[model samples]
Target: MDARYAIEIDGLTKRYGSMTALDRVSFRVERGELFGLIGPDGAGKTTLFRLLTTLMNPDEGTAAVDGLDCVASYRQIRSRVGYMPGRFSLYADLSVEENLAFFAALFGVRVADNYDLIAPIYRQIEPFRTRRAGKLSGGMKQKLALCCALIHRPSVLFLDEPTTGVDAVSRSEFWDMLAELKAKEISILVSTPYMDEADRCDRIALINEGHLLAVDSPRGIVSAYGERIYTLSGGDMYALLLAARRLPHVRRCCPFGAAHHLSVDADFDAAACRRQLADEGFADVALQPAESGIEDVFIKLMNHE
Candidate 1:
C-alpha cells in the first residue's frame, strides 16, 4: 500500500501563562502506521493530543488530521478521529453495553454498526456486558474505553498514555491489541512514558520539557548513541552514584535496574575506573560492555539539555 500521510503537525506551540507546553513541535504519521510519542510526564504529549483532536486551540502553528484543519474543521475531524484521553472518563454508573451505546449514539451511529471495528477488544469484556464500568479491572476498563472510542470506525485514533498505572500483563496485552488494530489499516498515534514501548512504533519522537529531542525509527535513535555505557554495582550505592558523576572520564551516570549506568568519555580507561572503585572499598566490582537502549539515550539527551 502507498504510504499516505494521515496527520501533520507543524511548528505547534501552546502555553499556559509563562510555561510553554509544546515548543515548535512538528511531526507526521503515515496512514495505517503505529506511531508513538515517547516521553515522561509533563512532556507536552497530552497537550499535543488535545490540539490534533481539536479539544484546545494552539497558540501558534497549524495541525491537520486526515486533511482537515484542527481549528476550522473540528466537527469533521471529531467524527473521523477516535480519542482516548490519558485518564478514564467513562460513566462510572453505566454498564459496559450502555457506555458503548451512549458513545455510538453521540456519533449518530449504532453500537452494532461498527461491531467489526471493536469486536476484537469488546468481546473480551462482553462477558461483563452488564457490569458497571467503575467495577471493572484496569485492563478491562482500557479495553472498554478503546471499544467506545472506535465504535464510530474513526479513520485516526489518538491514545494518550493508555497503559499507565496498569499491570505489566495488561500492558503487554494492550500492545498486542494495538498490533492487531494496525493490521486493519487504522492510523494510530499513542503517547507513553515507557521508553521500552518506543521500539514497537514505526517511528518515535522523543520529547523533553516541551522540546523535541529526536525523531526516527527505534534503531535509528539507538544508532545515534555513540557513547560507551557501563553498569556499576557495589557497596555504598549512593556514594558510587555520586562519585561516578564527579569522575572526569564519566560523561554521565544515572540509576538503572538496581545499578547506576555510566556513559563514560570514549577515551576513558575502563580498567582505571575499576581500580579506583576498588580502592574506594567497593567489593565484587563488575564492569562490562553494554548496549544502549532508548531510556539510556533519553537520559543522555536530558543531561545534555
Candidate 2:
C-alpha cells in the first residue's frame, strides 16, 4: 500500500469454474500515470479490471486502489474511481442530459458541480442533449459514456476498450481527451485489444491467454526484442509464409500488413534465404530488415510460454 502508487496488485488470480481467467498476475500503476493493459480478447484484461474496480473479488491474492484493499474497501474504491466498460452501458432510453444527471446524482453530486472536468468532452454532445442515448452515433455514445464516468471527478479512471468500435477520427479525439485528463493528475488504467494503441500509454503490460507476458514502456519492449527480423514480400504471401518457415534458423514468421515479419537467429543466412525461396518456385521474393514492434514482442513472449 504505497502512497505513490494509485493501484497495486499481487498474484491476483480469477477463475470461472474449470477455466482460469487470470493467473498469478501482478502490476502497479503510479499515481497520475497513464498505464495500459495490452492484450487480445479473453486475455483476462477485463477480469483484472473488474477485480481492481471492486466490481468482483479475485479468487486468490489481492488488489488495492488508492491504497484501499479492493475487497475490504469496495465502497470507498467505487466512490474514488470512474469506470467505462468496453460496451456502452449507459441508459439507452434516457436523454443525454438526463443520463449525465443521473450518474452525477448517484455520487451525490450535480453535473454542474464538476462541469469543468468534463466540459471539453461534454460540449461535443451538448447539442444532442435532448436525444435518446441509444440514437447517438458510436463516437457520440463514447463521449457520453466518458462524460458520465467523469461527472463526479474521480481520482482514478478505468477505461476498458473505450475506442473499440469508433472511427479513426473519433479514436484520435478520444486519446486527445485522455491527454487532457492526465494533465489534471488522474491515474488512468486503460485496457485495449488493439496493439497499435500501446504507443499511446506511458507503460504497458502485455498479456495473453491468462498469462502475463511482459511489462515495460512500449519502446522499451520493442527495443528488448534483440532477435533479427526481416520483412518478406513480392511473392504469393501464403506460399512465402510456408517457404520462409523452413529456412535455417527462422524462428517465427507471421503476416504483418503487406509483408510477413520473419524472426531469425543470428546464424540465419540472408543470401541463402533468398536463394532457397527462388529455388522453391517463389521468384521475385524480397527480404529486407524490419523493426520489431509491440505485436512482435507479444507474439514472441506468448510463444515462449
Which sections of candidate 2 miss by over 4 Å? none
Model 1 spans with C-alpha error above 4 angstroms: 1-3
Error of 1 at 213 (Å): 1.2
TM-scores for every candidate against the unseen true structure:
0.94, 0.96
lDDT of 1: 0.89
After the best TM-score superposition of candidate 2, give how far the Cα of residue 269 lies from its true spot, in angstroms. 1.1
* lDDT against the true structure, each candidate: 0.89, 0.91
Which candidate tops lDDT? Answer: 2
Question: Model 2, 1-305: lDDT tens per residue?
Answer: 77678999999999999999999999899999899999989999999889989989999999999989999989999999999999889999999999999999999999999999999989999999999999998888989999999999998999999978667787777888998999999999999888888898999999998998888899988887646889999858997898888899998898999999999888888999899888889988889998888888888888892
- The TM-score between candidate 1 and the true structure equals 0.94
- For candidate 1, lDDT tens digit of each residue in 142-256? 9999999999999999999999987777788899999999999999999999998997898999999998899898999989864688888877889888877866678778888
Per-candidate clashes, comma-separated: 0, 0
Weakest ten-residue segment in model 1 by summed lDDT: 1-10
